[model samples]
Target: MLRHLAVRTRFFDDYLLHAAADGGCHQVVVPAAGLDTRAFRLNWPPNVACYEIDAPEMMAFRERVLAGQAAEPAVARRVPLAADLRGEWTKALLGAGFDPAERSAWLVEGPLIHLEAAESTRLLGEIGDLAAPGSRLALAHGLDPGEAAGPDSEPGSGPGSEPDGDPAGAPRPPGSAPEEDPAAWLTHHGWRATRHDRAAAATSYGRPPGYLTPRLSYLTAERRPPAVAPAVQGRS
Candidate 1:
């Protein structure tokens, strides 16, 4: 799931990085950055710096998987930050030399399920506030079949990978309200999003090697100021 979700070109994350590269955004931040090796694999420009933010345990797990491998990153600098996004991640990242004005790109891949609607608002609001005008965000948000519903809607929730000790553990009860309208929420926050359903994405990228799991849905959003859509203005 990790490899299939994070590393595929058809995924918004891949597009996010490509857009950032094209824009010459040197500083990049990845939240809940578990097992992600883009800094080590992608040919980041010499001027760029990459930050990985996640639980300390997740970072340690990645270290174990990458142990004894040539661990040099393609970028000139890489920073590791251990913190919970639901907490004071902004403070932790800033303390670790993250410049809010760095014209950075952010990836919140696989993050919304772990957050509440309010938490999503706070985190993303801060991101939108801090990001330079042209910075980008690539996110994955759970869909409420009721809203973005039509012939394109697909299955969600499964043998739930719920976290045991935390309240986020249990499978979301059957009739609970969705966190928020994924596309509308982001759009109201001045982000223009392009939605991609799971089934379409899997087909576009072909099947994952051995698993056909469709745990992720996508939103490829470019951080913009208010309604100044580059699309309407004929910009890419």
Candidate 2:
């Protein structure tokens, strides 16, 4: 399980860097940011702005910890917006100077599983709405051990109890089934997605396949441009 988490962390770290450097996405947004310190640790390009959104308590906790450590962000701009993901957090994000017209990179990790299926769909839809053409996204998707154990299972008894497990012991929400085809879901939302399975990721990272379980995977996607209607020729 520890190895699994290490691989997942490294994967997303690389994804964010590539999105900013190679993909030309200067604006980055991390929903359910929690205690993540990418804004401080990553080497962002010039004029890059990174937004971290989470609940009020989590935001306050992160601020206090960073303050104590005197941590300075590597990015040119780091904005921490305290807003609940299950609510209208987009307003707070825009008010914090997020420009939806510009291409952006989004990281969605460790949040969706805790939300109901409908809530998860709504969250992704909202993200699609904000993402402009050429925007990049990386997300963690799949069933955790707790989910596999069935909905009625206790939280701490499963793999979710580990340090890298479910955040804050939040059980996988009821009626939240894993998306069978995450790539298809992205395509439906006008994004080109590529899914990396656990085995492939482990091999890429030089980790043994036994280290990671097949139940979890990651998806990296880019928002496609809107389709234009064809012009009709007028009868002469």
Per-model lDDT: 0.65, 0.78
Q: Which digits, one per residue and each the tens of the lDDT, describe model 2 over residues 131-206? A: 9999998888775343367544332221111222133433333233336445556766677766565545776777
Looking at candidate 2, the ten consecutive residues that score lowest on lDDT are 156-165
Cα lDDT tens digits, model 1, 112-205, are: 7778767776778778777876777777665533335543345433221221112332323323322455544555566655555564466556
* Candidate 1 lDDT score relative to the true structure: 0.65
The TM-score of candidate 2 is 0.83
Where does candidate 2 stray beyond 4 Å? 143-180
* Highest-scoring model, lDDT: 2
Which pairs of residues collide in model 2? Answer: none
> Clashing pairs in model 1?
none
